[model samples]
Each structure stands twice: as C-alpha cells, then as structure tokens.
Target: MEAFFYIVPSLMIAALLSGVWRLMRRSRRVARAWGGGRTAQARCLRSYTTTSGGGDTMVSTTLHHVYEFTTREGRAVRFEEANGPGTTLEGDLVTVHYAAGHPEEATATAPAPGRLLAESGCLLLFLGVAIAFCVLFMVTAHEMFAETDGLMP
Candidate 1:
C-alpha cells in the first residue's frame, strides 16, 4: 500500500513533466520557423468559442479566429491561429508570418516573452507543490507502518 502511494504520485509527476517539455519544444520550433518567414496582411474571416471541461469542473472557453491571406506567389491560404482569439474582427486586417515553403502554417501572433515567462513560472510552482505533497505522504505512510510494526509481537 505504501509503495503504491509513492509510485502513483511519482508517475503523475513524470507524466506532467513530459507534457510540459513537449509543449516547450513545439513552441520553440514554431517561434524559430516564424522568425525568418515573410509577413503579409491577413483578413479575419470569423471567430468561434470552444468550450471544454463542463461536468463538475470549471468550464473553460477559448475563442478561435480564422484568417485568410494571399502569399507573394498569389496563393490564397486560410488557417486558424493557434492561439486564442485577439481583438480582431471580421474583415479586419492583421499581420501574418509564413514560411515560403509552408504558407499554410502561418501565424498571426508570435509568442510574447512575458507570457512565456509567466507560463514557466506557473509550471515550476505547480511542480514544487506536487513534489512536496508526495514527499509528505510518503513520510507519513512510512511512520505509520513503522509504528504498526513496533506494536506487533
């Protein structure tokens, strides 16, 4: 039972760390790709809200914006921005960055340094708290088992 308690939290923390690492890696790749890409004016086509986590948990909503832009080669491409919707409206002109080879993978917004810092800080904070709780639970379980063993025979 004590082993199970320790193993479960350890697994959970490992999984969380893996997910965070993957997200950071993908963000860096996209940022690098956009840095050398060309910029063009894109028009906002529409906006829609996506909702998740409804039952028993706090419902979260994200607004997605679809945009259309024409490349220098006169190719028309439409794609939804990866980030949530901004202050853009229908038919509004926004700046888009796209690589010459992959115009479909365009982005209207670049990752902000401040936002990235905040996200990293939050992840660190959560990791610290989770590790602390796991340690506390393991210590408590060890003490209880020790006391029971001492009482027997």
Candidate 2:
C-alpha cells in the first residue's frame, strides 16, 4: 500500500535519528570521562556472558567484564562494562580513566584521534547513503502512482 511505503520511510528516519542521538550521548560521556578523569591500573575481577534472542533464529551473546581498582586515597571501587571477547579476561590488568569523585564510572580505552575521525566519517557517509536511497525510492513510487488512475481491486 502507498501508506505503508510512507510509513516505512518515516520509521527509517526515526530510527536513524535515534541512532545518531545515542552516538552523540556516548561521545559526550567518553569525552568527559577521558578529558577530566584520572588514570589508574585496574585488575579484571571477572568476566561473564549474557544471551538474548534464541530459538529458530540467531542468538546474540555479549561479553561483560568487571574491573576493580583502588584510588590514591585508598578506597576500592569496582565496575562492570561490556566489551568484546578476548579484550579483557580475569586477572588482566588494564588502564582506566575515572572521575575522582565517581570511580565507578570509568572507561578502559581512550579513543584515538584518527580512529574517531574515521568512525564519524563512516557514520556520516552511511546516513547520507541511507537518506538518498529513501528519498529516491519515495520519489519514484510517488511518480509511478501519480501516472496511474487508481488502485485496481
């Protein structure tokens, strides 16, 4: 149906916007954490996996790691983060950056300048291509429908 076509494009736009919003929030979080936080060596306390969506389709599993570190004032803090497999294992030592007041909010890796630029460029290109295709498809469909008299039952 023509209504269905328009709805699909609207959904795609909404989804794209949602993705961009999430990316921006994460970028802000990472930037703030890395820029003003103190760095420390953290020990990998444990690792675990969580699964979702099984049966008759693909099963998705995500690896999460917990790390513990002590502050200069001698307080111990532990936090968990989801990361790819083999990135961190039990007993591994990794460098982390965390705010002085909130040691629980820490990041394991800092984004490299080149890598950040490339990632942003890739996201921009993807958005442009996806929007172009959606516009082209909608235009073509509208024109085709305009040339027709009406829907044949």
In candidate 2, which residue pairs clash?
A: none
Prediction RMSDs, each to the true structure: 4.0, 3.2
lDDT of 1 by residue, 102-148 (tens): 78878887646567657766876777787778778877767877888
In candidate 1, which residue ranges exceed 4 Å CA deviation?
100-102, 121-125, 128-153
TM-score of each: 0.67, 0.74
- Pairs that clash in candidate 1: none
Clashes of each: 0, 0
Clashes of 2: 0
TM-score of candidate 1 to 2 decimals: 0.67
Error of 1 at 150 (Å): 12
Off-target runs (Cα >4 Å) in candidate 2 are 51-61, 70-77, 84-87, 99-104, 149-153
lDDT for each candidate structure: 0.76, 0.77
For model 2, residues 1-153, the per-residue Cα lDDT tens digits are 877767898788778777777776766566655765588899999999999888888998888988899887898989887854476789999888877776777777664656665776788678778877887877877777777744522
